[model samples]
Every structure is written in structure tokens, then in C-alpha cells.
Target: MARIAFILLCHKNPDAIIRQAEQLTAAGDCIAVHFDASADAADYNAILNGLQDNPNVTFAKKRVKCGWGEWSLVQATLNAVEAAVEAFPHASHFYMVSGDCMPIKSAGFAHQFLDAHDCDFIESYDFFDSNWIKTGFREERLIYRHFFNERTQKRRFYWGLALQQRLGLRRKIPEDLQIMIGSQWWCLRRRTIEALLDFVQERRDVMRFFQRTWIPDETFFQTLVRHLVPGREIECRTLTFLMFTDYGMPVTFYNDHYDLLLGQDALFARKISVEASQLHERLGGLYASDQMEFEISNEGRTLFQFLTGRGRVGRRFAQRFWEQETTLGRNRELMIIACKKWHVAKRLVAGIRDHTNVPAVEYLFNEEDAALPDLGGIETTLEKRSRHRRALMRMIFDHFESDRLIICLDPSSLDLMSDFFADRATVRLLEISCSFDDDYLAGHARRVGLAGPQTGADTMARLLPTIRHDMVYERDMMRDADFPNMTRISDTGSVDANAHAIAQFLGVSLETGKTLAETPHLFVD
Candidate 1:
């Protein structure tokens, strides 16, 4: 069995840190903690007192005051690693993680996997060749010297870089060194750690060069590991599961993320919220197990889909950057069901979802209305809600990347309805006028606060003919002069029958198992 030593770097939440230490130490693994020097003294002392009885837990001799994108973070990590190495010489592997990290699997599983594979698990990508750095200065991170804290003093930091750029002041990277960067967390073999320490002791100039570079913790060890170990022995990936936003901020895990995290292939997960006491309590049971191998139920497919890129935003809404009509083309197959009745419209959305693979959305407009709730506290401009509805539609169309998008519109979305009808080449417009049924018309009028059922019927009869529609669904036969294309649909028909009529018009097929109407909360009114 491979013995593992954990290096935990922390700044706050002493109680949670203590809980983590207890769990790891109980698993027959040793841990070394480095508390940030700037943190409260009470927090540090509390951690010490809590773990004082455990022989497996130790603390760094000195704490370094850490900051985001600064050299201090790397220094604190070094202190913790050194402490772990000195305290646990029998440890065959060293895993560096944050204090917020928790194991998803038993410690035995991690040890067994490490023992089975002799390769080092760390994400190392060539700095210039890869697009890992998304938000900030990419190439400049290596050439230009960064002195200011980028997060705290944003203006001065940029100003400093700008001044350097103007002066043509650039530092030459250490010769013969292939620069690499990746996630800060890593699990390295004992031999790799020894080799890395030896290189650091001999290369003070290289150390000084990285000291002034941006976010050195993410680059320092990652760059050095390439030269220290053989390429075949490196796995080029981390064992810890970490997620970040487009802005490069870590996404904190919560209590409800148990399934998402546990199903992942990763042995450990990081950036957990301190207040996630229930998650902490649940994960506390995963320790000191004799079971060596466990099956990963999800294998991380669903988790990554949710955490990466534009997909991070849920289906109902998308990022503001993606709220554009850039992908709209003549090849698009989109259908707009301009229906106002909540009861009938919901079943239609559900039926379409159950029978067809096409993505169907209910109340694509009027999200702010009672049927569908708005994104909490998302303030919008004073412009008409139609503009907002159009933007959301464009985002969904772009993000979904499907052959067809079936949308249900609200009573108030006339402007949106008109906009889609004008685009005859791309959109297939379907109008469900008040002729569907007397009950439906009455319900729609009452729900929308119209004057009367006849008033609602008259409004649709007068306005719908002016708009171009490929098809109209009605319960009673309409005058051929008004509806050139008509499909008689019984309001009393089965949901499947209504779904089949819709599928037939779109040249698609329907299945019966899963439906969108089941998730009524996701649909906006």
C-alpha cells in the first residue's frame, strides 16, 4: 500500500479545517497544515488545540501571509510540504490541496490507485501552446514582472504592466526551461518531490524569476515537474476536482452538490464552502475504509457539462455574452407556438419533450410573469420585455445547438411573436388562437385578466390574420379565408395525440418516457 501525506493550506474556518484533519488522520494518513499569517490568531490556535492529540497532524513552523495571484501562496505551500516531508518520511506520495478540500472516496481508494499507477498526477500544459489562461494576461505572465496584487489594486496592477509594456522592459525566461502552467493542486510521488526540492535548492535564480511573475503557485511547480520527471511518468492531470468561472474565480461547492461531486472520477474535491456543514458531515464518513476499488457512477460527464464554458449557465438563462443572434441562419429549424393557456401549453411542452429529442422550452417569453419566475434579483433595463425575450431566445438557440427549438410564447409576447413571424425563412410559426376550446379561451382570458372570453377570441381573430403563420391549431373549423393553413386539433384530445400532431408538422418523431412538463418550475410563465 502507498502511504500518502496531505499538505493543507488554510486561512479561515478553523472548525472545518479541524474536521478535515480528523477525517484524514483517522484514515491512517498524515497531514501538515499551514495557516495564513494574516488570519486571526484565535483561528490558528483553535486548529492547533483541536489536532494537538493526533500524532499524524503537524503544522508549518512559520505561516506566510497569502494573497490571490501572489508569491505568498506558493511560499505557504512550500512550508506545508516541507512540514509533511519531515514529519512523515514513510509517505510514498504527497498530495497538495486547499483546506476546503474533501475526499469523495475512501483514503484506501486513493492509496490503491496511486500504488497501481506509478505516474505523477498533475495538469501540466505548455504555457505558450495552450489556452489555459482565459481571463488575464496570457503571454505577458511569463515576460513581464508582476509586483502588485492584481485583485486588490486592480488599477495600479494594470498601470504597472502598461508602464512596463511602454518601456519595452521584459525579462528573459530561464534558458532551456519549457514553461508550463496548470491547476495549483497536485499529487506527486515521493521521488518527484525529492527531485523538485533538489532543483529548487540549486536554482535560486529560477526561483527569483518566478517570484515576480503572476500567480507563481499555479506555474512554479507545474513548470519544474516537467524537467524533474520523465514525460511518460506524468499523467498531465490532477486528481482533485476543481471548477472555475469564466472570470477565473473558483466555484464553491454547496450541500446540494453531493451527487455531482461524489459521482466524479476525482479522488478529492476543493473550494468547498465553509458553511456547507451538512456536506461536511456527510463526507466525513468517507475515511479509513478497507475497500480499495470503487466504481464511479457518473465518470464526471454530467458534472463537466454543467461547470465548463457557456454551459455553466442553466437552460432557462444564459450568460450576457451569449445573449446575441450571431448563430441565427437560414438553416435553423425553430417553431414558435404562440399559445397563452398555461394548462394546455405546459402539456404541449411536456408532450414534445417526451416524444421528440428536440429541445422544447415553455414560456420562452414573459419570464417575469407569475407562470414563470424571473432570475432572482436580476435587474433589467426599462426597455420593453419583448427585447429581453428576444435576447433570451437567441441565447437558447445558440446554446442548445439543436436541429429544432420548440418554444411556447405567453399572451403578452405579441412583439416577440411578430418578430419571429417576419423571419419566414428561418422560423416555422404556429398560432393557437382562442378557437382551441371555450374552456381554454375562458381560462386564458381570466388568467390574463381580459374583459371577457369573447374579447380574447376577437383580439386573436383580428390580429393573427395580419401575422404570417405556417399553421393554426383550432378545435372548431375556422373560415378558410382567415386561416389558409389549418390543423383541426380537439381540445379534449390526449396529450400524446396533441404531441403527435406537433411532431408530424415538424417532421419529427416522439417517444413516451421523459417530458419537460414534469419540471414545471424550470419553465417561466
Candidate 2:
């Protein structure tokens, strides 16, 4: 068991601070708390009383009156380290977090991940580069003098710092030292923390220089580490996901951010508030688990699964497919179910239905297809792979029973259509793309990892001629006038929106200018 020493730098959210402290406190993984001295004394004493009985939890003896962009924040972090070192000397790693930050990954997974790779997880970027953030953030933070004290209301800003920089009044950096900037939150080795403590003690001048600097917390420790090591990228990116506002302050998260939280691979997220207490509660339960089932499942989750879940994407596609099949399938002439180019299929079905109405369409992909993606590399057994394909065939055929059947297919869908559907029916391939240029199709194709322009063009050349005898409609979405007596449609606009010439091809006519908002879908099957 590789136990960690966790330090929390907290200022607000008393309930969140108490919960996180209790959650991270375990037998081997010790937790140390440092509530800002500026906070209410009663709140501080209440937290101390709550955690005092827990041997694994400790409190900072020297609480710093922390303020944003001030030295106090860094001082508080340093004090938390001193608290942790004293309480748990056998700790494997030292990690800093905030009161608002809640773990996304389980602590067991975190311990395993840290134990597997003995590398530092710190994010540091050069002051000279604009690659990480906008240039203005750097200029104001690094170039000029900045001083602010929230408690005492002391403030100072001097443009002379820039002029002095022009006249070379800047303090000389030793050739061995270089500056780097990064997020204040960091996880480091025992040796690294010791080294930083020693460096600060020895170089009071260097620490004082940073004291007058703007937002010193972000720059102080990161710059010192880079100055000491001089030219190596951070081994691990910071695990916390801090949503930033337009003003660059950390944005508070809520329930609306729950999906975004799921998508992120981070262990922790920041700036949570009372409004999103439900999010915090959910995250708390998740972090306590020993293993993450979703991590393994997420890798194999494909577009098919997302499509079937009737999520936002699935609902959009369902609504579009329904507009046509709702009317046309009832005629019993011939219906093709193709989802190879899912995005194009949506547009084509929606656009075609605008002019040609169809019956309620029924397309079925089972729980397995809707659950897993194309597992070409994953499922390598003939028996398993064969079974997977058959499952999909069963799903496709279960819907339409007719001699006339041509389904849209992708590499993930199936390899051979002749096996299940029977080749008796003449297959009329209706290939629809926004344009011959992959850039047009890329918006949709890229999601499934089939966005290569040159590759798509090459496939078109081979497949179109191979089935030349039965090919019916081979039209590039915006390029060709293959639909005689109809105007060409632009790929950029939505077909339902009456995209001028594009809508004309679909034969969608409104009452003068009422648009899709009024007539929407004209019934025609």
C-alpha cells in the first residue's frame, strides 16, 4: 500500500472542507488541513474538533492569512507540508488540493497509478511562450509589480516596473536559474519538498523578490523547481480540472458540469460551491470506490453506444430519422437501413424527408452494439468476433424483411452484407457526403476516427466502381445536381432550415417566409 500525504489549502465552503478532509483520511494516507487564518475562528475550531479524534488527520499549527495572488497562499501550502511531515513521516507522496476540489478518480486508483510510475506530476511552462495561456495573463502577472491584501485592503500597482524593465532595472537571474510558471496545486516527492524548503531557507532574497511579484503563488514554487532542475517538462499533468471564467478566475461548477466532469480524465476538479452540493456528494461516493468500472468501459464505448443511449446525440439522430421513416416505411416499397456515415445519414434522411415523406422508421441495434464500439483490435478471436458481427446482423435484419434491402455500413457495422441480408435484392448504394473534400465531411467523420480526407476519397474510388452495375444515387452533398429538376444544396446549412438552394433540392417550400419554425415537416410518405 503506497500511502500519500494529502494537504488541503482551504478558505471557503466549510461543509466541503470537512467532507474532503474526512474522505481523504485513511490508515496510511494521512490528511492535513490548513484553513485560511482570515476565516471565522469558530469555523476553524469546529473543523479541528471534528478531525481531532482521527489519528490520520492533522491541522496546520501555523495558519496563514491567505489572500489571492499573495504570498500568504504559498505560505499556507508550505505550512500544510510541515504539518503533514510531522504527522506522517512514512508518506509516499505529497499532494496539494483546495477546499473546492473533489476527487474524480478513486483514491485506490490514484495510489496504484502513482506507485506504478515513479514520476513527478507537475505542470510548468516557460514564461516566454504563449503556448499555454493568453499572453496578457503572463504580462500582468510577470512583467509588472502587483500587490494586494484582501484582509487589510492594501493595494499597489506600478507601471514603472515595466519602464524599469525597459531600462534594465530588473534583478539579474543567475545563469543556473530560469523562470517557469504553473498552477499552484502540485504533487511531489518527499525529496522534492525537502529541496524546496531548503532552497527557500537559503535564498531569502529570492523568496522576497517573489513576495513583491504578482500572483506569486503560481510562479514562486514552479520557478524555483525549474531554476533548480533547469529544462525538463513536468512528468505528470495536474490532476485537477479548474474551469476558468473569461476573466481567468476559477469558475464555480454545478450540476450542468456533471457530464463535462465525467468526460475529463482528471482525479480532481476545482471551484465547486454550495449551489453544486449534489455534484460534490456524487463525487465523494465515486472517489471512495476501490476500482473504476467506467474507465475500462469508456475505452470501448463507441458512437453506436452513444447513438443508442438516446442521449442528446441519439435523440437528435432519432428525431431526424423519424421524420422520414415515420411516413415512408408504411408504403412497403423498399426501405434501406444504413448507419455507416451516421452524420451524413442524419442530414440525408432529414433533407430527403423534407420533400419525400416516409413512414415511421424502425432501426434496431441491440444492447451490445449500443454498448460497445468497433472492437477490431480488442476482440481478436474468430468465435467472439464472428458472434459480435452476427449480433449486429440479427439487429439489422430484425427490423426490415424484404427482398429490397441495402443498408449503409461502416467498418464497425459488418464486413459482409451478403451473409445476413441475402444478395437476391439489387443493392442501390446511395453515397451522400457534404463534399468530395474531406474537410466538409470531417466535422462528422472525425468523431468515429474516420476523418482522413485522402483515405475517404480513395475508398470512394474503389467502392463506387465495384458496385457500378447497381449504383443508383452517387451524389456529393453540395457538389452534384444528380437530383434533376432540383437545385444543389450547400453542405454548411441545415437541410430543415430552408438553406436557400439546398432546401430547393429537398423541395421544401414554406408559406412565403415562415420557415421551419412554422411548417416544420410536410407529410408525404
Candidate 3:
């Protein structure tokens, strides 16, 4: 059992921190809380109380004040790391997380991943060329004074103190200094942590130099580690999925994005807010298991089995095929539907399944050509179409139940389908259109007395209107004509030819068409 420790730096949101601690505990991982002294101790105690006799949790003694762009935040983190090392000396790895950070994977899997890599997971991107630091400096100088100074009710001197450091007025650092950014949240091997600590301790001059520098959080550890262990076994990637707002503040993850986060293969995510309580609740299940399932089948099989049992076996099978196609490149038990021609869908599915690594193709026949002979005894015609469409949709949805979905459709189709099923499930939508230059289709509707050409004058015009007006008839006709060709309706040409065009338009790789398979519903309505 490789031991892992979660070091969380918390402020006022003790409730969130406590919830995170509980999640870590459920994963059989140890938690260490480092409360900034500036925050209320009573609140910290309340947080500790929530943990309630959890043997895996420990409250750190040292308290440090942290300010953005100040060295204190990094200092506080280093202090906590040192304390965690001493307390959980046998821990295989130490993960530095914020109160806002949440684990996306089980601690067991995290431990195994670290054990295998023997490398630290810290997203180290070249920030030197990025406008981030420069922009931060400008915002502090101008925006900080314009907005925050008045809101915080701070004196002129205090505001100046805050802004001066952020604006780089307090430090004479070089303009061309190589800036590197890793996630403030990271998982480090014990050896990496010790080496960092050693470097900080021995190089007191370097530490002192950085202490007075601007944006130390972005610079301190990155500069030191790059120098200490140049080209060492440090992953330039962080195991955290973090979303940033336009203002650069971290935003809470939406519940709908849960599947995306899971598919990203990252270990943790950061900046979860109080509003994301529902998201936290959902993720709790992923990390709740005592032992992490590393094998792909172990993770996928359970979900697949459940979906298959729900009378969604066909869709589940498709999804399984997509996964296999993406991972193994062997297409065995898969199906393809070409809107253009039956023979094309059939031959492509058959050829891929038989010759390539793809699974057997279960060609979905159009209602007109080969009505579902299986449902011959069905009574009502309307009921039959509904049932058939539902069955077809179910198969598509099921295939994507455990994998990422990449929907390929025109803007009109995307608008219709997304609006129709907005509340049904949590799936990511990526809208694509083959042509951006031509407004011929837009003008054709106007000529047919359906609607005028879409103009940028109104925001509503920019987006496809959800309301089904008479204009939608023209749009529908256009869609029907285009969708079939797009899906390789012809048997004479290759499915790969048209499929490749669609995939290219969507900016995705044509690897077993897994993205298309996973994304079941294409809007043509």
C-alpha cells in the first residue's frame, strides 16, 4: 500500500476543506490541513471537528500569512510540505492541493501512477513568452486601483503596497526572465519535495531574492526546481483540471463537465467553489472506492455492465466498440450508419469489422429500406417510429456513457438538438460548420419567403433560434439534403472519404471514428 498525503491550504471556507478532507479519507489517503493564521482559528476548529476522529487527518502547527504575488503563499506551502514529510515520513507521494482543489481520481490510482512514473506531476508550461505575468502586472497597476482599492476599504498606503508588488515596481527583476508555470496544485514524489526543500534551505540568497519579487507564486518554485533538477523526472503537466474566468480568477466546475474531467485522466481539479457542492457530491463516488481500479476494463466494465442491463445493450456495445476502436484500433463489434446509402454503411461497417481491427459492424438500417423486422408485431405506426428512434438514440447515448463525446454537426443542427435535449443529460457539445464564408444557405431561406438572412445586428440572430418558426422548414430541408451526404449516403464512394471530411471540419483525428461513434445524436431537425 503506497501511502499518499494531501496537503490543503485553506482560508475561510472550512466547510469545503472539511468536505475535501472527508473525500481524501474515503480514498484511504492522509490529509494535512494548513490554515493561514490570518483566518479565524475557531472556524478552523469547526473544520477539524467535521473530520471527527479520522486517523488520516492532521492539523499543521505553523501558520503563515499569504497574499497574491507575495512569497508568503509559496512559503506557507513549503512549510506545510516540510511538516507533512515529518508527520507522514513513509508517504510515497505528497500532493499539494488548495482548499478549492478536489481529487478527480481515487487515491489508490494516484499512488500507483506516481509509483510507476517516479516523477512529480506539476504542469510546467513555458510562461516566459505568455502574456500572463505581464498582464497581471498591468491589471494590478490599473484595474486594482480602479476597483479593488475602493472595495477593500484599505488606506492609500495599503493599496499601494498591494499594487506596487503586483505591478513589478517593488522588484528590479529582468524583463527577459524565463517564466515557467506549473499548477499551484501538484503531486510530488517525496524525493522531489526533499530536494526542493534542500535547495531552498541551502540557497538562502536565492530565496531572499525571490522573497521581494512580484508574483512569487508563479516564479519561486518553478525557477528553483528548474535550476536544481534541470531536465529531471518532472512532468510538465499537472494532474489538475482548472478553469479560469475571463478575469483570470478560477471558476467552479459545472456538474455537466464531470464526464469531461474524468476523461481528461487528471488526478485532481482546483478552485471548486461553494456553488459546486453538487459537483463535489458527484465526484465523491469516484474517489469513494477503497482501492483504485487501474485496468481500463475494471473501470469501464462495471459501468458498461450496468448500462447493458438497462435494455441499452446495443448502445453499450457501440460504446464498447468505440473505446476498443480508439484504444486498440481493432474494429470488431461495431456499426456504422451512412445517411447517403445503405450499401455504404453496410460495406464500410462490414469491411472495417472483418479486415481491420474494428469490431463487427451492426449496420442500422433506415426505416424506409429495412424496417426493424424484429418489431413486426408492433400495433401503432406512431408508436413504432417513436420506439425505433428511441432505440436508435439509446444505442448512441449508451456508447458514450463512459467515454468522451464529440458531436459533429452544423450550427443549425447543434442548436436544434442541444435545445431539445438540454436538460436530459450532461454531455459536452462542440459545434462545427464546414463553411464560414458562404451565406448562400442563409440567403436561400429569405428567397423562399421563410426568413431573412441572419444579421449580426441582434444577438439572437447570431445564434440559431430555438423557437421553431416557419423559417425552420427551409433549414430542415437544407439539413436533410446536407446531413445524408455528410454521413456518406453513397455506397459508391468510401465512408472514410466523407467521414474524414466531417472529422477534419471538427478538428479531430480519424482514429477508428470513436469520436463520431461516441457522439450519437446529430442534429438534422
Top TM-score prediction, candidate number: 1
Global lDDT of each model?
0.69, 0.55, 0.52
**Candidate number achieving the greatest lDDT relative to the actual structure:** 1
Model 1: lDDT to the true structure? 0.69
In candidate 2, residue 146 scores what lDDT?
A: 50
Estimate the TM-score for candidate 1: 0.63
| Candidate 1 Cα errors over 4 Å, as ranges | 246-248, 291-293, 299-525
lDDT of 3 by residue, 1-525 (tens): 567888888888787777778878776778778888788879878987888688788877677876665567787888778778887878878887887677777766776777788767776666555554535343232222222222234485367666766776644333433446655767777777788888778877666666655556766666555555556777776677675554666656666545545544577876556686678887776787655643221122222232233321222112222222222112211122322222323443443443334222232222333323334334125344333433443444444442222222222222223222322333222222222222433343343322323322232243224222323442344344342212322223344664565344333467544344333323221
Cα TM-score per model: 0.63, 0.57, 0.52
Q: How far in Å is the alpha carbon of 270 misplaced in model 3?
A: 2.4
Q: What is every candidate's alpha-carbon RMSD to the true fold?
A: 14.9, 18.0, 19.8
lDDT of 2 by residue, 358-379 (tens): 3212222311232233444333
Which scores higher on lDDT, 1 or 3?
1
lDDT of 3: 0.52
Error of 2 at 288 (Å): 2.1
Stretches of model 3 off by over 4 angstroms after superposition: 50-52, 130-134, 138-179, 290-525
Candidate no. 3 TM-score: 0.52
Compute the lDDT of residue 26 as modeled in candidate 1. 86
